[model samples]
Target: SALNLQLMSLTLFDVFGAALGVFVVLTVCKFVEEELSNINMPEMKGKEGRFQYTITDVKITELNLTHADLQFIPEVGLLFDVQNSSITLSFHRRILYWFFYDTGNINASAEGVNINTILNLIRDDDGRLKINNITCDARIDKMKAQFSGTLGRVYDFLASFLTSGMRFLLNQRICPALNHAALVHVNSMLETIPVRTEVDQYIGIDYSLIDDPVVTSRSLDMNFRGMFFDLSHQNDTLVNYAVDPVIREYDRMVYLALSEFFFDSGMFSYFTAGIFQMDIVNEKMPKDLEMLLRTTYFGAIMMLNPALVEAPLSLQLAVNSPPKTSIKTSGATVVMTAIVKVMVLPPGQPPVQLSSMTMVYTHIHTSFFYFFRILLDFFDSNIFKIFSNQSALESLALIPLQAPLKTMLQMSVVPLINNWTKRGVQIPLADGMDFIEEVVEYHNGFIVIGANLHFSKGLREMISVMPPPHMAVYVEPTEALPYDSDITD
Candidate 1:
């Protein structure tokens, strides 16, 4: 029975080992599930007085580098070990126990290992985990000098590599995902409005004098008389007649249309109007002897009585007068030559008027590099040095190692939200131009269809109390309209 007792003891040890292994696996599974499940996405209300469902709880756990524990290995002169390798990143709160409980059932077969093994499995050849060699002088005097110089180069190279990788991953992947999520959120909010039709109308009226033969002759005579005598009163009368009620009506219509759109859409945004040409043209009068009589008489009298006239007038008269009657006739014919012309009244159709309204949605996101830089700076300080004597080297190497993980985690939520945007949602309230052009322009220079809002101080304050990310609606005429048939119908 002694041999049987020893065998029983060995069997008990095996059972205990198996139980411990199970516990570790269960813990890892639970953590992974919780990290993946707890994401926070914002909810938005539509114009139809309905709510649009978005992923307020967006959890990114798979590649989260923040969960990793760093370690410095002086033997290899490289920081390669990470502990508690699992991390849970989410936009919202999560129930850790429940997630792990279910995960345990699914992944019961695979055994869980230490954090270092997990990281090493995923580490690249040139990654921070790679072994590094350090050479130092045998003499104790030179040991410090050699160690500092060789390790310094290693540290600098590692830092540069990590910084570049982090920047590259964020710019290429994480930023795009964030951009897509924003676009989806905007589009979902836009779908709550009921109307999707874009209407733009232009109206213009022009007025001018009807240049008939009689009117031309009279106008020419008036001009000639005005030159000889003051004609301010006559000029005023001409101006009043040329500008008609019809032109005033055109201007009024334009103003009314703009006002109505603004009032109906509840948009008090400022707009600017510009005019290219506001001009007047009169017909030319046919040759008239009466109109030229003043000029001819003045010329002849000045020439005949040079002693009674000023020197300038005498010279003008001498220059103007001809020697023979035939020559005088020719000169008068040339001077009095005038062609009768009719005024073109803009074809009795309205002139083309162009008006534009710009609607902007100002949304600011934290810079991609800002958060990374903050993390980098924080780790560089002496405070972080207490965590590891060789923290500088570890920090530099870990920077690049964490880049891909950061990028992967940051962008992980994008595809899911993007799909929701493309599916299209409908809003139920009577919508205006603001509802039609649901365009969401991303901060990174991309745009998608969504409702745009320009809010006032009061409205913005009201929205601030509500949960983020809020939407603002602006109404302005645009070429694009929403694809939803219910709103358009």
Candidate 2:
């Protein structure tokens, strides 16, 4: 019951995606098998000329389902709906005959008997394939006969019997066997598909919801989650990246969509993990700043605030909006804006909060090399000041520290920002597949992306060369009776 509930909650898209691949290979096979098996007629006998008839086997030499149309029902998920599908199949029947007066015995065979039909495919309540209907106006195109000995006029009866018996068989057996086989085959296939894949040491894809697929006239969509973990580091805070939104589609076989949220714990683990402190004794002034400080009173006054050699730095990252993702010809891109706050604790004084600064980070990742590159397009720090409360020192310095202070502040913090941007985050977009075409950012938080997979020519050729499903008869041998003569002796 628990397992059933779990499957019920899963998205239908994952099952459909995997099933589609298997369906392509089995479509023709199933079609032809149904066509041949439909010719199941009860045995017929005529005392006038002793004869025995039976279909030894049925084989489908040709089949085609590529032109079939697709249909979807959102209520039932992505059920397989096909119409006007056709097939060309052939089979064989064996026969035995004798003269009216037992003058001679005959053994014969019929080969190359052809059949054609149109098929309709559907799904049952259990999510298995069901062949609802089949329509065909076909007959045995050609039949080869191998005869040992035949009585006169018996040939006419044999031909008439073959025709009538085949027609009667088609009326009785084809639909039922076809429906049964389809259901069993599809259910078996569903068990083989994998619901999740580990991309690497740090990330994995969760396709558990893929069974609840969404389809429309445009394309198919499925929901999945990305599992991200940092094995080496332990943090008390956890980030929640689960966001639901209505994702829009643009083009391609865009099947998979995901939404990710950001958390402080995740950001801290990614960007900062060590003590960051700056003090007067430990601070190394820039060459130009140091030169200016020695030459002017303004630099002399700056020294009074004291270097942050012992001050402990506190870092906070605040996201203004959820990151937006989209696909480009090169690879996937994430555009986001964040405010970085830095606080310093001065010796014998309360902690001082620096000015709040905002930065827009645009990340471009390439599918080919799997490299992450971030571009800082905008930085807003209009009210940024290093020592805003030190007005007395500023008056004594004889010059305003706004311009020089801004330069010093930029020099101090920009490198740390750059280092975090360069080496902090990485997403392997092309982990297992050949390439990802594009990613779409939704109005909500969901992200839609299309994946491109490559199949080898050899594999395609092997599937084409495979023989269609066939029905064969195997009779068990009867056991010999015990010798009664030995017991009498």
Candidate 3:
């Protein structure tokens, strides 16, 4: 009976070992599946009603490829290359019951991995960013996988032989699998990240590449020739007019050079039509001004303020701003100057008009108060002086109006201009790219943004399904091109 019991115990142990092997393999597969499944990218798509870019012809040049964990110098003028790269990875678990001293190890190795790729940036006819002239070669030199435990020395010996066979199978499969995986990622990135964004209903972004991008050992250089458009005034006299030195600086990753922009005079005509107008009527005025309105010297005031009449009075208010715009910038700030006009129209009298130029300076990124906040400053308004010379009564009445009028203009009109500067005109070219830093500038008629795109640190781990032992090697420092200008410090 004891002999039979021992036989049954041995049989049970064998079954358990087999079951444990199955569990280990299944666990590895599940881990990989879970990791890949968690890559949700929908958030990269911009929210509705937010500005989104539809980038076209994004020409990336001179991309540097390196292992996520390794770094070494390369030969001069040679693009960094990977050849016969190898990776070794292992996972271990301990069994503490009947197989108390046993440890399970799952080991994987890859050798002779090689890849070369070249691509061109272009926009399709439909205005989508496209990779053109793509050419790539990927190959796995060798691959091996093994599962080993405390079965016996014989099992370990056999595992090595089986691993060789598995390596061949994996080698045959890894190349296609790797290429497919990379394609999936690239397609996802292009699909979700917009290249052309709407600054507003009336403005749009143009990011077409103006010249071929240059690649060096250290960085890729991209030259862009794009500007903003005012949709409502396409045919204005100065719409297409621009001066020379369109791109004056290229010191950072993003640059902007703006020469001039024209706003149609009619853009502010609503202000001229009495949107800011108020009637001066005796019924609504202070007793002092009301008594003064009844006198001959104040009779003119009665015309403007019909409330002064014995019968119910009728009055009309009209306000306007004539259109001319000039814009300049200094140290993260923009100053804008515009001419404005105000008019008062009585039921039967000629319209009275007053004119002045309103200058506003907006400081970008100047404070810590609001998220992405900007400062607005109104400098030296003498609008009331125009009313002062007309007459004493006119001057007295109009002086009180200036404060409210200034507040209204500052609240309503200045913000629109500020928004135009922040969203419509400024371009954040490097923000969304996975590996990029940018400096932005503006000049004559173009936006000159110098961008640096490279292999970011830890990129290998980000894309790896499991951690592997390897270091990047042969990373070469990039040489500056003849045309390269370090305008940014």
lDDT of 2: 0.38
Against the true structure, whose lDDT is highest? 2
By TM-score, is 1 or 3 better?
A: 3
Candidate 2 to truth, TM: 0.43
Model 1 lDDT tens row, 149-256 = 222332332222222222222222332232222233223333332221211111111111122111111011000000000121211111111101111111110100
lDDT of 2 by residue, 364-408 (tens): 543312222112211223433333233554433434444664565
Supply the TM-score for candidate 3: 0.46
Give the TM-score (vs. native) of candidate 1: 0.15
Report the poorest 10 consecutive residues by lDDT, candidate 1: 3-12
Q: Is candidate 1 or candidate 3 better by lDDT?
A: 3
| Minimal lDDT window, size 10, model 2 | 1-10
Count of residue pairs whose backbone atoms collide, per candidate: 27, 20, 43
Model 3, residue 340: C-alpha shift (Å): 4.4
lDDT of each: 0.20, 0.38, 0.34
In terms of lDDT, model 1 sits at: 0.20
Error (Å) of candidate 3 at residue 365 is 13
Cα deviation of 166, candidate 1, in Å: 0.7
Q: Which of the two candidates, 2 or 3, achieves a greater lDDT against the reference? A: 2
Task: Order the candidates by lDDT, highest first.
Answer: 2, 3, 1
